[model samples]
Target: MVVYAISIYCSITNDDSNLLVHEYMPNGSLWDRLHTYKKAEMDWNVQYKIAMGAAKGLEYLHHGCDRPVIHQDVKSSNILLDEEMKPKIAEFGLAKIMQTNKVTNSSHVIAGTYS
Candidate 1:
């Protein structure tokens, strides 16, 4: 499985808020393809591929990096697909880089969407 490497470029918006730009995925997101009505049925092989790819991407973020990264928002919508249906992990807005490998709960408000 290929781990999707996201490239982020920061830009200042009109209101002074920061905006991040990412590469475009022609196939859109996994959620749209799965939940929304489509002519083609998603095959088991393709499903497995996407699932494995996403898992590996998370593994890379947590263990492969110099500092462990916790992706607070991990959902189907965040997993984008390329032209060939390869899964790519997107949206790092709620991601956190930890100083240590130890996983801990936070007292601060939990981040990410409900669904």
Candidate 2:
């Protein structure tokens, strides 16, 4: 999917830290594009494309996969963009996958920063 970051390589370090190298995202995150850079104003078409791509990615995570993945943290900073400005969802530190045996999933602990 256009909105999902494709991991190029993954490895575990001696200290047990996981390393993941994803496809190069030249455009940076949506937050950076919207705030950090002011010279470039995204056209309506480009904005729509990013929106649709992000929606499709979320749809895939929630339904298309074998197990539903809940992205607890969803914000502008988590949406990265490639060279073509295609949005890709990133940073899954707070994500949770629904258990196969559980019909419903709930978390009492609050997670993620303020959006």
Candidate 3:
């Protein structure tokens, strides 16, 4: 099991938007769902499945692939819901390869934010 990866060569826009991948999720972000009473009551079973799915995805990122991948940002807002309420992760502008020994300062914090 090697802990190494290559950046997928995805683009980051001048506005810092990731241009490689993303799909439409009409329900918006997970934060929006948590804020609304109608969506706050997710069943334990469903949540468990979501957790398991995300874990598997992360595990795949870390080990299942040919190289070790690091998901730089893992936040609720980056996750979107399908019509069936299944989670689909979005936003990878901040992500990078795992094997790059050189770490830069920008990796330390969010861009354009008061820190």
**lDDT by residue (tens digit), candidate 3, 4-92:** 12223455567655365344567666667767884656788767755665566577676675555567676667666666666665665
Candidate 3 runs further than 4 Å off:
1-18, 100-115
Error of 3 at 40 (Å): 3.6
Preferred candidate (lDDT higher): 1 or 3: 1
Clashing pairs in 1: none
Cα lDDT tens digits for candidate 1, 1-115: 3557565655557765667787778888888888877416568888888888888888899888899888889998899888878788888878888987477766476789755
lDDT for 47 (candidate 3)? 76
Estimate every model's Cα lDDT from 0 to 1.
0.79, 0.77, 0.58
Arrange candidates by lDDT, descending.
Answer: 1, 2, 3
Q: In model 3, what is the error at residue 5, expressed in angstroms?
A: 16
Best by lDDT: 1
Per-residue error (Å), model 1, residue 92: 1.2
What does candidate 2 score on TM? 0.81
Q: Which residue window of length 10 is worst by lDDT in model 3? A: 1-10
lDDT score, candidate 2, position 94: 88
Task: By TM-score, rank the candidates, best first.
Answer: 2, 1, 3
Tens digits of per-residue lDDT for model 2, 13-83? 67757776767888888888788654176888888888887888788788877888888888888888887
